[model samples]
Target: MDSKIPQIIRKSFIKEIIKKHSNIKVQSGVIDLLSECTTVSVSYISTICNAICNRKGKKAIGDEEVIEVLSKMDNEFILNMFEELRK
Candidate 1:
């Protein structure tokens, strides 16, 4: 997350957690997942989310789609999860 999380870790998380979850095929869920996880930083989350949504960094054309999805996901489950944690 800093300037040094290493590409390997990013790839692993994307492949393991982000990609494996079928419902997460929804673009915004990826952002919610990354943000709620905490140990990773938002900058790192953004990179991973973008990579996953774009599909291996080849589909830059979907950038707008990705933004729309992120806006929807950021509030739904992510805020709920944080509230539960606070309790």
Candidate 2:
């Protein structure tokens, strides 16, 4: 969403999600999942990133915020589990 967040990072995030959740195939679903997990509206996510990039000149969501959101959804552990699954 953030214009400064390179397309590659967004793509990578989507790819990682798909790789971790094989059953989630739709891009929209991925968006929904992110929204649900973060308790942030998908539109807000898009808007916030855009604002941050355009107005504040930030590249991506800060790691601390990212970690906090992931922690709320217990997704940090899932990411670790996925790492094991990958191996």
Candidate 3:
């Protein structure tokens, strides 16, 4: 897997999300840190999804696998999903 994160999850996107959620002024260094952290987190999640696929004898990771991994990793993830669904 490439160490380079996708453009979709770049610093600008992180800034946008943070801007939407909080009113505090975020420094460039903080945005950069968040971007890097997001990249690492996505990579880790992908790794877990891939491992689940391997265990299930599947060649591709699907939404179900990713959801399962997320649910196991964080209950808040499932709560967030429910919140979105409610919205």
- In order, how many clashes per candidate? 0, 0, 0
**Cα lDDT for residue 83, candidate 3:** 59
For model 3, the stretches where C-alpha displacement exceeds 4 angstroms are: 1-9, 82-87
Candidate 1 lands at a TM-score of: 0.30
Instruction: Give the C-alpha lDDT of model 1.
Output: 0.57
Sort by TM-score, best first: 3, 1, 2
lDDT of 2 by residue, 53-72 (tens): 55656777654444444455
> How close is every model to the real structure, measured as TM-score?
0.30, 0.26, 0.74
Instruction: Tell me the tens digit of each residue's lDDT in model 3 across 1-87.
Output: 354546445977887888899999988888778877877877988999999899999999877776777788886866587558756
Model 1, range 1-87, lDDT digits (tens) per residue?
A: 665454446545665775566554546555556545654555555676676767755655354544444455675665555556657
CA error at residue 39 for candidate 3, angstroms: 1.0
Candidate 2 wrongly placed segments (more than 4 Å): 6-8, 32-87
Best lDDT among the predictions, by candidate number? 3
86: Cα error in model 2, Å: 19
